[model samples]
Target: MDEYDFLGDVAVAGSVDSFDRAITPFLSQAFHAKSLLAIHFHRTRLPKVLFRWIPDKTLRQLFDKRYEKLGFMVDPFFHRAFLVQDWEACLLRDIAPDRFESSEYFTNYFGDTNMVDELGFVARIDNDTAVHLSMGRNQGQRRFRTNDVVRFGQFAKILAPKLRQILINQPADDVVEAQPLDRRFHAMAQARHTNISIREAEVAALIVQGHSSRAIGLKLGISGLTVKVHRRTLYKKLSISSQNELFGLLVNYVGADA
Candidate 1:
């Protein structure tokens, strides 16, 4: 079928599941992506994996075991996409931090994925929720060109309204609520270390949440230097040196708590 026919069908899809099934085939064909993931973000809660279409068994297993569990915490694209309030699409590289490729998150989780590139669509569904649709190309494949990003943007404009409708019709209870970050960290820090201070724990929590030192300072009403000081102290107390290590520790703590 042509793009017009497929989009028309998607527009009239009766359910989110049906819309997803219809669109996945079209997207896979258009982008040459072997894996697709749709993640729903809720306010102050763990993001839900709304849908995943991965053809390779090994890749699926790795995603479920690692990426689904901990990698999201450190994903620059995941964090940046959610922060976006508008409906838009972009390549992961476009949204990633300047030094993202050299970061530990890249070295630890993303590097192992063997995926050459990722493109994402970010759509805000409500006041406190949004969804991100990611397309990944397998290793050794040529990266998406400029034209691909443009085409994906057009597709996103068509998909966003339909997805918003589907998500709006779901029961409110479908979204799980998580405990406050500070409370969770307080308990975890107490159980893990005796030398870490409350301020240091707060810094660590923000770091794991994907906030830069400047952002953390703004949120806490402190100077950037103070935030850095807290971060350095926290790193020393945790015996970790990089944000990647801090992310690993938080993920492990959260996983253990679960």
Candidate 2:
């Protein structure tokens, strides 16, 4: 569809629900995407999965079970959209790291997924928040062409203002705001009474806060090896094995608090 046709559809979208219904069909048709995932990023907090349209139950479960963990932190698309101020639409391959395919994030989380390619639209909702709309293609499908990216970027620019309005008008009661990971970790630790040491708690907090072992060590005036040891001890204390499990623990705590 042309830009005018797309705008006409947007014009009729009076609410968030209507906007979502209208746009997803258009995006699915226009890009030949198998699914969509919309994420809202807050400057100092974990991202909220605002909307998802994955039809495959297994893919959805994999996202919840695996990708919600440290894998997201390593995703170039997430890092760029969340950290960078400029908003634009781009293909995932265009921004991925040189060694992305060999990275643990790819091998363990993304590579196992059915998606072959992803295109993202970064829509700024406010100074501190942005909505990332991802369009995914399943395996055996062709990657996005240059003209497709250009056209999609143009469409995203046109849609941004309407998306911003929809988000701004969303009811506060309906929104589930994610608290900062470090704060949530502290709260979880306090409620557990699990004989976790202060140092271990600190390490765990930083880990959930998306800090690398080297970075945590630097912050704590210790070595990376010490940070790893503390992390292992903390995980053993909490009976969690992976970062995904730790993330699930924090999410459970947040839900209980809510």
Using lDDT, give the best candidate's number: 1
> What TM-score, to 2 decimals, does candidate 2 have?
0.65
RMSD each, Å: 2.9, 5.2
**Where does model 2 exceed 4 Å of error?**
1-5, 67-71, 173-258
lDDT of 1 at 156: 83
> Which window of 10 residues has the lowest lDDT sum in candidate 1?
173-182
Where is the poorest 10-residue window by lDDT in model 2?
172-181
Residue 114 lDDT in candidate 1: 79
lDDT of each: 0.76, 0.71
* Per-residue lDDT of model 2, residues 1-258, tens digit only: 665666788888877667777688888888898888777666655566767888877778887764444345556666567655657788988776554555445555556776778897776666777777788887889888898898888887766667767777876434434444455576687788766777886776566545678878987999999999988988988888976677667657756775
Q: Which residue pairs come into collision in candidate 1? A: none
Error of 1 at 19 (Å): 1.0
Please give, for residues 1-258, the per-residue lDDT of candidate 1 as tens digits.
689889888978877688888799989988899889888776566678878999988778878887655566556555665677777788988776555676566666566777778997878876678878889998878899999998988888878767777878877555455654555566666778646777777777667655678877887899989999988887776677888787667667878976
